[model samples]
Target chain A: MDWKRYLFIALIIIALFSVVIFVGKTQTPPLVIAMSMLATTLMVATPLTLGALSGVFCETSAVINIGIEGMMLAAAFFGWLAAIYMNTIFGYEPMPSLITGVVVAVLTGGIFGLLLAVLSITFKVDQIIGGTVVNMLAIGITGFLNRQLFFEKNSVFGGQVPHAPGTLPIIHLPVPKVVGGVCSLFTADGCPTFANALGKVFDQRPIAILAIVLVFVSHYVIFHTRWGLRTRAVGEHPRAADTVGINVTRVRYINVVIGGLLAGLGGAYFTLESVPSFEPLMTNGRGFIALAAMIFGNWTPIGSWAAALVFGAAQAMQINLQFFRDLIPPAWSFLQQSYIVGLTPYLLTMLILTGIVGKTVPPAADGQPYEK
Target chain B: MSENKRSFQDALSESPLVVPILAIFTSMVLGGIIIAWAGGNPVAAYIGLYQGAFGSLNALSETAVWATPYILAGLAVAFAFKGGLFNIGAEGQLALGAVAAAWVGYALPDLLGAELPRYLHLTLALGAGTLAGLIWGAIPGWLKAHTGGHEVINTIMMNYIALNMTSFLLNGVMKDPSPTNVIARTPLIAETARLGTLFAKYRVHWGFIMALVAAAIVWWLLERTTFGFEIRTVGANPDAAQYAGINVKRIITWTMAISGLLAGLAGAVEVTGLNYRHELGFSVGYGFDAIAIALLGKTHPLGVVLAALLFAAMRNGGTRMQFMTQIPVDIISVIQALILLFVAADAIIRYIYRLKASEDKLVLTRGWGG
Candidate 1:
């Protein structure tokens, strides 16, 4: 990595640690409390990172992809649907059900991505309108599907998938005693230790770690590979790229489709991985949050993941604080204002965007069509 | 050749008619299938929607009552979109307006320590609502013009500030002092300031007519005069408009203020005409739904009127459909979503219709740099 990029990352880590320490001191939280916060934060951060990474491809390719929330919601619904079907009619068991769920979810995301591509590229529709439509379409299709196929009467979807018997959940690792003590300081509660005291220090989810890997992979794919170079070139200057033999529209379509598939896979996490059952309108606004993170991260995969972590941490902190509201001061102790508390992530995002310098820049040709 | 000419004359159509009409029809058809798939008769559910909205005198009254605020809010969004601004803060502005109007409606009599004259009290309530909206809209407008801050970000931020402030007021400072009143709402308005029903027993009031009149005024403002021209010019391209000597920033600010005025009026009218007071649930998602209405209506005054009524039908019918079919009311939200999707992404619809793509397009944002 370049010295500047490394410096920027180190500064961010320092800032995050400083905030964590400051919050710890101010609240005088117990060690367990800190661990819970860290773990919760990682859980929240994983899907967010996945979604933002999904957003990176679409936004990078000049599609707004506002439909991320819808995509996630649809995928979650379908994933649950697959799981429910597996446990009921097929008797095919949970493992296969999860695989099917992931496949179906990715397919849904691809469909929506296709819609976005056709609208913005073929018809040259407004990206905002396209995004809004995606959100609404998702809401409508899901709501309609839930009512017709899932919500009412003892339907297949309302049932739960049985967990595979004898699945091992990691709790502890055999680490060298001295090194373990050092790692424990940064480690969050509920984290499975790595071998020989070389534990993952952050309160990290397995999916979150996967998401980090996806970010680096995405960065490499976008900036290093031939396709990545072409996609970036097309997005930045389609006319220039076209002259140099790049197919701008085709690249946008491919990238958007891949992004949708990733988002769809993320959707499965919410249903099959994060929680079991799917609720109506369950995705809430995570898609929009991801979109915001993508913007805040300036449309790079790794940057988007970093931004998602910040968002995840904020969400985790809110939940943790809610659980320990008693420790809060009486002046700010307005429990009924939980709705306002939930809005912390959004508020912080806007504040950061406004305050920070030169981060969150859009791709050069973002929201534009290549018409040559 | 002669027959072809005659056939062509018969086939002449208004340019924008087919798309929106088809979009609406397709949504209804899809909604019907959804209802049918849920084990409810599609026709029956639709009948319920129609009956709930316009079947009887009571339904008509309720429909009008619902349509009143929707029309006003729809106009608010449409007006701003015409001026090339997305006023997503309408929800916040509407809430503040309701709170302000509610304060005036109930607290004004107490501040004076006696019941005031009818016309004067009503005027005060409306003025407060309008002023609240004006201030809300102007802040972001001024910020956008002067500081080059995007209105989308500002409006979203304002929504947080406005909502939190409203919550604090409703929960703390301006909360009802009456021992019996535990709900987060203001006191009741005096009978004189309250808008009476036009029909003897119907809930429909003067505000429905007022909303219609407001729509007409919006139509006039956008199409008739020079200021409307300036607003349209700025909306079309502020840079080009500036080159043509228009005061772009001032127009932008004015457009937002006007939009906010209409939004505020939506809340005010609801308090005066339908609800008779502002409470927590008096205005819920009307402002946000107005965006859908504005878009489906194609951002025209007449279109907004039609779109508002259509949305009002779905919202009104949704309850009965749920009550009868055991389907959730969120189904209506789905159909509305479908309509928005079809209208916004006309490619699918266009492909289905086999229509040539229209050269004119809806460019909602100017991207980042432009």
Candidate 2:
């Protein structure tokens, strides 16, 4: 049944790719276009993949974290701010400053995660409302500080929006040699075009690659470790886990903080990796979309990654459509509208949620606060 | 007389409003601290806030104007709370309502090739918006009832879809055709379809009165009606309500529809009474703010109105506060979030104030499986 679902998703992705190729009207070969689209999909999916992983960790430990958006937003802002300060105030070089920014962003996310833990676990606030509070606080604090630090005339930076430190360097994988070696049996020229296209697909930034690595690492940690067993036990039945000498509160706290760290990394992807600058509400509901992906993936690490990929492909299609606006047929002129194209990911989320594919079952005690 | 006075003190201490008021006060204090930390005088900021919100007739009028939508949207969320459902889709429903109202406001008369009477045109436009919101809100309710889809995620998805759809329409077909205009907005509404102001010099319109009336009606519907009783029963314990032969599914759907209707009316009023055209970025975050208002109001109709007014005052005063103290208007959102936190988690307030637990506990919603 799971394989069938995966196959269905694969078919959809292929169909979406075919549409992009058909409407692209470029002289580039379909294979090269498809390769680039896959690359774009992976790049676009980086933040979502991290965010979904964040959800997976918290929810697996029975802490509902709707505050992932807030966490990401705060991380993005503080991370960017730290980078700027490091460059201007401390005279640190770009590479070290960016690394410091990433660290601060992760810590900021962890701090918020701890705050959420205190509110929901220690104070026993409703988890949903607690998450909402985090979100609102993030928005208010970020917006307020963004203005005072950069936009205001009496700001710390004297009203100048400092130049972005720089984006993370891409990890250049040696894909062309691998592709050329594989293609040597079929062609005399060793498939230079195929090598080049495949090479570009492998050229992604460190965080994007880290996101892919973390998916597997998280899957291993959640499914194959003693800690994973304890976490699941606490989530399903805290009293039972407690009777077995497992500290439920400790497990939940650790998992939630780990989730925050993941979300913080996702935030860093926005400022440090992708754009090198921060924008208000720039997470732009990706955290919510990541939550959807987590649920759609049935809260499994690999499943969520797969779901994130589909969403990423949808966004990639939208991005690709913008370049090929002139190529859209007269009858299908509506496809040229960026707003219409942007609806695909959200509409797809809704459709999946309607139980057409399959019902998603959350953990039994997913949102309940544990008591002694 | 001495015993009566003691009892009065006890009653005042026990009143539900105590926690909310204290929460607001604490949040304000914290906000002042934030302002001071940001190198602004907290006293001047608060003074400016008070003056901007209520210093003059014009200020009061602006507060009323802002409160109009907050009141309606707050009611939308509060009404859903009575039915054991969370209608986060109010934002989307409100947007669709505005779109529907704007379409009717600008296109209807032209389509009919005649001018409609002022009263009829206004009513039709408002009705169109309400119906659109009702439909938008009902879909998530129906999905939750029939298919076990969670409203939280669905509502968020619907928001994106509706927002994108709105952007598409505003950028394309619904765009103002005037040669000078390039913004993603509709043309001005017909004069007949417009809501009239209470005073020529003030922006306060009939919508403010309608919001007050709507609050009273919501109170009546919730307290003095059988359907309201059913909603409360379902909200308290769905299994018990089901055992009593209530159609839980229908109630949920209707609750969402009504909630959406109120949200839509908020948008409609904005279009017909104030903005006179539906534009992108207008009424942004009003729906989300309504959530905090609903929570702060303790999910009561009258409480919602009061909370809306408070929120409206803060929003209206924010500009003046910024002007006087150089504090960012965004501080209001932080304060509102704090208030919501204290209200939702009343244990903190109770602990701080050393108050005993009240009998009426707010059971917002159950976990995912529930």
Candidate 3:
């Protein structure tokens, strides 16, 4: 179907929101709520987009990377730790320390990616189980370290991570803000109506903006570039690519390593950009959901980011369903429940997976171990 | 069925047990090193772990209790793997089973306005749980069989739905009614639905025996029966099996349903035999852990039993290891992950042991669009 048909996310969003509306109605203006939700979903979509982009890079090179979750998680903890350590030691500069943290997170993810590449590609382990091992390591190490550093406050964990949030910066998107301010001028909320929401949508953290830009960059790289052609060739038919003098193993390894960098950037979103502190399991299964996004997007960068936006909207709706419960008729309001609200993204994932809206095939050699 | 099958004498020297045992031993040694690095005396920690798993009647009982779930869950994964499928949805199936069993146990009698007989009530509860799992598992199987959907992705998505749905039921309609109860759990089952403990002093119950019998049944089905032969054949090669006139699609669906039935039984046992109620957080990761157990056991029924027991011991011992050394119990997961890593990527093991590679390899799953 040329795969671009997978971009039919409009129906998915409407279906999901209809269910939400069916459960209950909200007192807030639905349009305003939706606009705000659109803004927030993009914010939430950033990390997932990056994670899916990472998956695209790896999977498109014929390597299955279920370890994106673990990579992001490891990056999340270490990134937060690096930033905290720097802020405490290097004169309270958020930029330098936070940058260091982001770099460390990316490095950690890359290392984990390298581990996956070696285990699955070099050693020919089952890719899924190899990824499982990385996940276990991420969880165990992060949990163990979290206890020592934050819980027990042990000196051995790491000396003195900064508790300060002000040192962190929030980068504003000047373009979105100006446009939003003009749009909001007529709204009853007195201030520019769309200004705050538009700013919220556009004024993303550096990591968030990077995630959005990378979506386009990844798309261009995968579809338009010579390197991308070779990558797709390797993923779909390793022997064919190899016959053409492309280094299959090397491409898989290097692409997967870069995939890790993207996932690490996603992880940094959790600690540095989203929240200023580290918590156990803060990634909260988003990595897995990102995999779903990648699949839903038919393994394309723009499609994946779009899918991420859908998931992000679901997440946004989840947070507000309770407040919007009043929108429901009183009898049905009883049905407006947490689990059902929480169920939006998962249900949507499964529905999209059924390929009713769109169908796309994966790269032929996606999960197979290639041996010369 | 095939000329490549080994003779008794050949099997004796080249036992399938060797690689798995070595994997376990290597993992233990690695775990010991990690324990030492964590600042605990490795020998003492091992001693404590041993004591925790088998040092006393109480510890042994606890190990058996833990093994009850592991055995069934491992069997589910192993059974699926042998059928050329990866049953990642065991977690969801188990949850559905637990919740269904709990509903049947607690709500059925009240709905009927009479206390059902023990055998009937227990049977119904167990059957309901099994049925829920079968139905749940069958969806993905049917999807895979009919529409070329991958069970791996479908199963994971199922887990999310099952878990969230379960959470809702527990918190809302099914909540325990006790005044002090703030936990998300169901009311205790009717007395008739509960499984009796083997004896007064031990926590182990009839479920442990049931687990053993389940293992034996799985072994017999896979090794002795025609259906088992067909499943294995289809798993080995669907096209070849089809050419041989075997119904591959039906086998896949039935295989998944039965695998899910076994996993659901694990959840049923937990409710009727041990917990007596379904709690929101209980049995959270047992299904995922079963993947490691299945691989560790080499996907053989007997292997599954032994592997489940070993995993149970580690899990049970983890408590004591933590109490003594204050090392986080997550180390067990670490050891498990390491074991799976070595076993999954067996080249390192082969290189270390200088063993020849076998022509026949395990097929865990053929991921996405395969």
Candidate 4:
């Protein structure tokens, strides 16, 4: 199974890199284009990676959480709002204000997670319906407040939208040094072009790097910890877990809240990291796509991240096609239509779900409320 | 006489409509508080909303026009619920249906090189739209039946794929191509394909009546037919249905196709009976909103019609409410969400009102892999 997963990942990576190189050779160096596309893919995949992790945490606890979209949306708005108030009203520095926004976003997601727990666990509502409620409520509340706070003529700030504090700074990596060391084995003069291309690939914003780091951390935490064992026990057979004194409810609550925090960080990536402003439905259905990735990955943190990368590559292809439109070959004129390129990820999701690898099985007691 | 009066009272209290009515009332009250908090007079805003929805003949006509699509889309969702399937792809299906209708309306005459009779042309356009929607919906259903793929995820995947396909078609071959037109839309449909208006001054047309007739037909199909019985049996308990000699897989696929057909009809009517051409961004969110409508209506055909009208009124009234009080029309969505919340989680309402829980509980679909 592990070998199969690795092979699938390798095949997809090779295919995507080949396409990038082919497209790039027409205008620039193939390696440089391939490296840049890889970087873009990782950047685009960050939110999806985080969102899939969120799904993994909640579903592994047997509390189906389809409200990842709503949680991320609320966090994005509140985080952006917090940053604006910190800079404008409190007169804080840009760095500190942005940090404050991230914190607020995490807390907003946690609060909503708690709301979901109460509705599903305490009130005994259908989990799917509960998720729908959170989504609709988030859309309504955010849309209403966005208009009232920024757009209304007689509202706060006198109808002028406040200037965004600014996006997070990119963390420059020591990629050139690393690449130069590797290049010295083959060439007397280290390949500056190769090093520079690799450098661009490694240089990323803080949250983007954090998403990668979190994947390995979540993998270790979920598979090699006492808490993880309890989570699995409760999700699989709650009565047995309760009989064994595992405190099923407490484990579920903690896991679901953790999921919310991850989704919140994903939300922050939208407004605080990528763009410094908010837009209606800014997440743009990425949360649902994350769920698809989660299922495709069989609900593992590492596996889900790999699936997210595949989706990211598909999206990056769409973006790259737009940029390199003139370089497209005459025989491949259909690729010039960006919408056709946009269909890749969704079509891929369908194919994968239809048992391309094998049937994916969820946890035994998933979506069932424990009466005890 | 005394016994009959007491029974009537009991019936009113115990009716399935009780929860929906209370949910609507509670949502409006909460909506008012939100409006007041946002700095507008709640009373004035609500009064304006009322006037805009039903105060004049024009307002009523507008409400009916909006209700037509809501009714069809709502039925699409409700019908799927009856078959234990969640058809979230209605939005995409509806979009494709509109595209198909528009294509047939504007392109068929040229392809045939002759003008068709009005009735034949109109039927062909509408039929094309319905068939497109049916195919779009059936793919996911077939996959769900054959492959253990969850319909929820597959339907969502279908939505993105369909939307992108529509965008490609509209931007390329289907572009209106007028010198001044820069938008992605179809050319104006042939005059022969258009539906007649009910009145000279109002936008309300024969499509509204068609929606009502469709509802009645759906009711008959669900209640009085052997196929309906099979669908209901499979929905309630697939194992039992299989034991009783019903082909559960086929029923599941057909149910989704029928649901998609209704949703597609909604889009076709909008193109032929309302908008003369299909355009991007013309009918967004109706499919999503239909989910709330289905829940509010308790998944009943008659109840769906009422819920559709209620939603239509709120949406129609939002503009007037905004004009009068500067309140954003998004409040209607908030209220709709609240209503859905209360309906889905009736325990809160029961707790507040001190009522006993009812026996009939909604099951929706089973979780993934069930």
Ranking by TM-score: 2, 4, 3, 1
lDDT per residue (tens digit) for residues A1-372 in model 4: 266865776687668667656766878887887888899999999989999999899889898888888889989999999998788965646898899999999888888788778777777677877887888888888888898888898887677778778989999999899889889988998998899899999999988999999999998888999888889888889999999998888898898899889999999999999899999878877888898888888888988999999989888878876777888888888788888778888888888888878777788888988888
Residues A1-372, candidate 2, lDDT per residue (tens digit)?
A: 277667767877887788889887466578887998899999999989999999999999999999998999999999989988887755646888898899999888998898888888887787888888888889878988888887778877887788667888999999999889989988899989989999999999999999999999999999999999898888888899999999899999999999999999999999999997888888988999999889888889999999999999999998887777888889888788888889889888888887788787887889999878
Once superposed on the true structure, which residue ranges of model 3 sit more than 4 Å away at CA?
A1-7, A14-31, A90-92, A148-168, A180-191, A331-335, B1-14
> Considering lDDT, which of the candidate structures 1 and 3 is the better prediction for this target?
3
Span of 10 residues, lowest total lDDT, candidate 2 chain B: B353-362
| C-alpha positional error of residue A78 in candidate 2 after TM-score superposition, expressed in Å | 1.0
Q: Residues B230-277, candidate 4: write the lDDT tens digits.
A: 988888888899999999899999999999999899999999999989
Give lDDT tens digits, candidate 3, residues A3-29: 444446776676656655544444555
Q: What lDDT tens digits, residue by residue, belong to model 2 across residues B138-231?
A: 9888888888788888887888888998998999899999999989999999999999999999999999999999999999998999999988
Model 1 alpha-carbon miss at residue B286, Å: 3.1
By TM-score, is 1 or 3 better?
3
- Interface DockQ per candidate: 0.45, 0.75, 0.52, 0.72
Clash pairs detected, candidate 4: none
Q: State TM-scores per candidate.
A: 0.86, 0.97, 0.92, 0.96
Query: Which RMSD values do the candidates have, in order?
Result: 4.6, 2.1, 4.1, 2.2
lDDT tens readout by residue for model 3, B21-86:
777778889988877776667787778889999999999999999999999999999998888888
